[model samples]
Target: MTEESDSPMTDTDSTTTGPLVPEDITADSPFTLPGFFAALAEGRLVAARCTECDTHLLPPRPACYGCGSRAVTLSEQPRTGEVISYTSVNRPPSAFDHLAPITVAVVELDSSARLTGRVDASLEDVTIGDRVELQVRDPETVDIDPDFGLSYEEEWPIHVFELI
Candidate 1:
């Protein structure tokens, strides 16, 4: 009788091969926040795509929220998207007060994944359906106060949207 592959149970299948095992969820794996930020810092945007229901999970989780399936795989996301909604934060939190009147928006990426981010334009310059591209910047390069980041988030990259 064939021993069904003879691999250890602790092994996690490749991202596109099968369900995500507990062994696959690690700080160095894209399924976790640290891993997600690490990939973002490297100029790669990654998300979790559920094989069972085709749901995309940003800041990727191990399980598929759409179908409660663990058969999720890593998917690279497109930088271009359309603005779905927007608003201006006239009174942002104290940590972001220095950049008040910030224009933010919900963008639906070309991959159908959506995420909210700060827009480079002013509130008056933005409108629904505007084309935008994601921009990545080092945390220190952004204008926000240095203290705004938590100790653990000091190295995470910040993302913004630029009108296209």
Candidate 2:
């Protein structure tokens, strides 16, 4: 499949894959703008860590929410995590119309930080506490393009224990 220039990074799929975003949808990002895209571009799952409580926070920030510590550090997270909760967006927000019925999951990293992403499996197959791996899928493979550096999708293999 052809790759899109705007994708975070292209990954070869043994099977056919689809784009994560459609050209029709247009909306501003809801999360931290540059830092989010930058992490994907660099192939690292960046998160904020509290120096005081040692809490790893997703959506990296300048301060720690747990201990109210300003001394925070940004670190790359392990790509594997456990699915704490998830939902299939059959009716997505206006901006995600191109990707309706997508699976969004809250994943708990091994470090105990919870982060969210689109789940890359069928709705019937995903379950709470399922093991998942972070992956960067090319938009062109799916026939859509997100107006960002790259869009990522999380895939959960059948064997959940493997992630640990």
TM-score of each: 0.87, 0.63
Error of 1 at 142 (Å): 1.0
Candidate 1 wrong stretches, greater than 4 Å: 1-14, 17-20
- For candidate 2, give the lDDT of residue 16: 20
Candidate of highest lDDT: 1
- Candidate 1 overall lDDT versus native: 0.81
Candidate 1 structure quality by residue, lDDT tens digits, 1-164: 11222221121225553334667567888788898899999988888877788888897787878888877778878788889999999999887887888999999887777899999999999999888888999999887888888888999999999998
Name the lDDT value of residue 74 in candidate 1. Answer: 80
User: Local distance difference test, per candidate?
Assistant: 0.81, 0.55
TM-score of 1: 0.87
Deviation from native of the Cα of residue 157 in model 1, angstroms: 0.5
Collision count for each candidate, in order? 0, 4
When superposed on Cα atoms, how far off is each prediction in RMSD?
9.7, 13.8
